[model samples]
Target: MKRILPQPLMSLCLWLGWLLLAQSLAPGDLLLGAVLALALPLWTVRFWTEPARIRRPHLLLPYLAVLLWDITLANLIVARLILGPVRCLRPAFIRVPLDLDSDLAIVVLAHTLSLTPGTVSIHLSPDRRVLLIHALDVEDQADLVARIKQRYEQPLKEIFAC
Candidate 1:
């Protein structure tokens, strides 16, 4: 079973996602979804170096809520900065030190930063100890770094348990 379904949850999600996107209950669609659900994971499983293990699954919901709220607030702040004055913008590149050792955790942190408005993850150091971020407007670099560490990184560390 493990050999056949390397990632059972991922397979299920892909199958459901395919059915939802196709919007059909036809036998052909069902078969195709099943095939894709099975085949894709098999093909890509080698690329996954570490099996994703969520230590605190219960915290996922609250983490997502915080992420959504932050994104919304960031969107408003970015809009104001863009509409107000380019001269007032204090664009800067921030280096955020990582406490996460897991590759999956680091990737998630990077993606979350990129998803938020006004910030984009530019690079991850060769040792993966630091993540470089480009922000559209930064009033205090230290504050931004602290916020990112506390708001995003800490939650992820707990969830991924890295």
Candidate 2:
């Protein structure tokens, strides 16, 4: 029943993850993995009262490709700014408003933004509405905000927001 069992996918992942991690299969290990897998999802259920529903799986490939490219570009830009002859950096704050409402999706977006070099997700407003991102260099606020909204938020919205 839903009362005891949690997300089925989580349980399956728990089982496989433990198997791969432990590298040996014993009865005790199997039982422990199963128990942990089930328990974790049950505990995490509160975090997502409603399950995440990704609408377009195909879009993920292109999204990931772009993110990877951005990572490389960002790393280069940051390195140049730091190690070059002079730091002709343009640092500034940009507020990115969210169209994706789900907590999981928003957290992923925040983390992804933070992970990219030269940029950091500084804060998300208490209402979980707008994200404050610190860019190591910036040419224009409008372009940056528009880029974030268009490049990341739009695809994420299509994928996770329906």
Best by lDDT: 1
As a whole number from 0 to 100, the lDDT of residue 72 in candidate 2 is 94
> RMSD to native for every prediction?
2.3, 3.5
In candidate 2, what are the lDDT values of residues 1-162, reduced to their tens digit? 776775776678788999889887999889999899889988888887677566677888899999999999989978888888885688998899888888767887898899899889999999988999999889998998898889988888888853
Which residue runs does candidate 1 get wrong by more than 4 Å?
A: 16-34, 85-87
lDDT score, candidate 1, position 35: 99
lDDT of each: 0.92, 0.85
Candidate 1 per-residue lDDT over residues 1-162, each given as its tens digit: 989999887898899999999999999999999999999999999999987677898998999899999899999998888787656678899999999988988998999999999999999999999999999988899999999999999999999888
Task: State every prediction's TM-score relative to the real structure.
Answer: 0.86, 0.76
Error of model 1, residue 159, in angstroms: 0.7
